[model samples]
Target: MGNKQFSQAQKLTILKHAKQIGPKEAAKVAGVHYTTVYEWKRQLKELGEEAFLEHQPRRSGRGEKEITPEQESAILQVWNDNPAFGPGQVRSQLRRQGTTISIRTIRKVMEANGYTAKQKQNQVSAPERFEASRPLELAQMDILEVTINKVRVYLILLIDDFSRFILGFRLLEQTSVDEVIQLVRRAVDQYGKMEELLTDRGFVFYSWRGINRFEKYLENQGIDHTHARPHHPQTLGKVEALNKRIKNELFGQEHFSTLEQAFSALTKWVEHYNHKRPHQGLGGFLVPAERFHGQEQKALDDIANSRDVTAQIQDIERSIVNLVLAPDGSVTLYLLGQPVVIKGGSHV
Candidate 1:
C-alpha cells in the first residue's frame, strides 16, 4: 500500500518463511516490516490459500477524488449543449443547478475528450503593440472580397492608425491601382496627408521592380509607401481590425438584392461609423471624428478668436530672416532668424 507492493508469490513466500521462523525474522529476511508480515499472516488465516488471489476493487480514487459517471455525463451534457460557454460559465451554470465542479477538472475532461475549451486565456490581456502616437501619422489600406446576390465585388478600405477612422472606402466590381490611389488622395484631402501609407504587397498596391504606378503616385505626392510585413497583417493592425469588424458586424450578416443596395447601405453605415460609433482606443468611447477633429461645429469660430493661431504665425515669422541666392545660384535658407550662405565656384 505504501511504495512497496507484494506480489502473490512474494506474499506466499513471506508467509511460508514466517511460519518457519517468525514474523520479525521473516520481515528482516524479506526486507519488509513485522507489521506487514503480521497483516499478511492474518489475511492468509482469514481466507485460507485463496488469500493471495485477488479481484479488481469496486471503487478507485486513482489518487484523486472520485467523479461519478453521472456527474461526468452532466459535464459533457452541459458542454455539448452550450459549446460556446467557457469553463467558468459552465461551472457556474452547473453550480446553479446544485452540481459543483472545478473549472480545472472540467477543462481537463474537455481536453481529454477532444472537445474545445470552454475557457482559455486569463481575463486580463497584454497591452497593444506598435501603435502610432498622433493622428495622420500612418494610414493603412486593405481590400476585402465579398459576395452579394451571387455576384462578387470588393470593398476597398482605408483607416487611420491612431484614430482608427475609416477615412474612405469604395465598393467596386474589382480593384484597380487608380481607384486605390484616388482613395488615398481623397483621404489626404479630407483628413490631411499622412506620413506613410501602409498596405499589403498586393499587385494593386505594389510591384517589386519599381514600376508600380501607385508607388510612383505616392512618391510624386511626397508620401512614403510601405508594404506590410510579408504575410503579417498585424503590421496594418488598425485597418485589419476595422475590416474584421465590418465583415462580422455588417457585410457578412446582411442580405442584399444587388450591389447597389449594399453600397447604399454601406455609405450610410460609413457615415455613422465615422461620426457616431464609439471606439475603445479613443478612450471615453469617443467617435473617430471627435478624436480626429473634435467639435467641428463652432471650432473654427473659436480658433479665429483664440490667440493660438496668432502665436503660431508670429513664431513662424520670427524663424525666417530671408532666402538668398548666391552668385553660383545656390540658395541659403534659415530658421532662427539667420542666414548662412555658401557659393559654388561657378554657375554653368
Candidate 2:
C-alpha cells in the first residue's frame, strides 16, 4: 500500500501501536510504509507530541538552511557592535537577548558577512588555577603602563579573585603609593572591604626594607596583604590576563589623542566588560556584575530553570549611583533617584 495520510491523533496512535507491536507490523496494518513509521517514531522521540502535528516542512536552501534571515541579521549586528567577539561569544550574546542561535549558525552568518575568525593557537597545559571561595575573599591589584599620544600613563586595576569582578580602576599620570591607597580605599568604600589583597612586590605596593604605606593602609583597614613571589607573573595570572585583554581589546582597537579621551574610553570599556562581557571562567555565561552583587547562584538557577538571565542585565542600569542590599537577599540600585530592585534572578 502507498504511504497513507494520517491526522495528528492517528499518527500518535500509530506510534503507540508501533511500540506495542513491531513497526513493520504496525505500518502494514495502518496501510503505511515501515520507513514512514520509523521516521514518525524518530520525530516523536525528537520533538514529542509536536512531531505529530501537520506543519510545512522547512525548505532546504543555500542561506535559509538553519536559521532565518532575521537571525543572520542579528548575528551580523552583534558582530558589528563587538568586532572582538568570537562565534561562541556571539552565540552567548544572542542567547542573552532571548534568541538562541547555535555557534555553527553564528559562524556561518559571520563568514557570509565577510568576517573570518582567526585560527586559535594551540594551548599548552598550565599550572592549576585557583580562585577564592566567595566574593570579597581576596582581591588582586595590578598596574599596567601604556603610552598614549607619546605620553606614558598608568592604569591601576583591582579585581576580586572569586568573581573576577573589577572592584575599581583608575587611569593616572603616575603610579604612587598614595594613588594605590586611594583606589583601594574607593573600592573598599564601594564594595564592602575584602578580607585580603594580593599584589606583586612593586615598590609602590611593597618595600624591600619594610612595609610600604600601601601595606600600612591595608593593615589599618584590617585586610591582609600578600605579595606574589618575586619574578613570578603566573602568581598574579588573573590580573595579568586582564591587562592583556585591555591591551588587545581596548588600546589595540581605538586610538586616543589625549589622556582624557583614553580615560573616557577606558571607563566605558570597563563598564561593558563588567556588565555585558561573559566570562569564560564563569561558565561562559555569567557576567562579573552578577557575581559582584551576590547574584551568581540565582543566575545559575535561572539558567537551570531555562529562564533568561538577561533580565538581570537589562534591569540593572549602568554606572550605578548606589547599591543597597536588602535583608531578604534582594539588591536595590539607585540611579538618579530611581530605585530598581532585583531579586531571585529577576528584576522587580
Candidate 2's TM-score reads: 0.70
Segments of candidate 2 deviating more than 4 angstroms: 1-64, 303-308, 314-348
Where does candidate 1 stray beyond 4 Å?
1-128, 295-348
| Pairs that clash in candidate 1 | 86-118, 87-118, 87-119
lDDT, candidate 2, 228-257, per-residue tens: 988888889999999999999988888899
In order of appearance, the predictions have TM-scores of: 0.50, 0.70
Predictions: Cα RMSD each: 21.2, 14.1
lDDT of each: 0.66, 0.78
Sliding window of 10 residues with minimal summed lDDT for model 2: 57-66
lDDT of 1 at 124: 58
Tell me how far candidate 1 lies from the true structure as C-alpha RMSD in angstroms.
21.2
Clash pairs detected, candidate 2: none
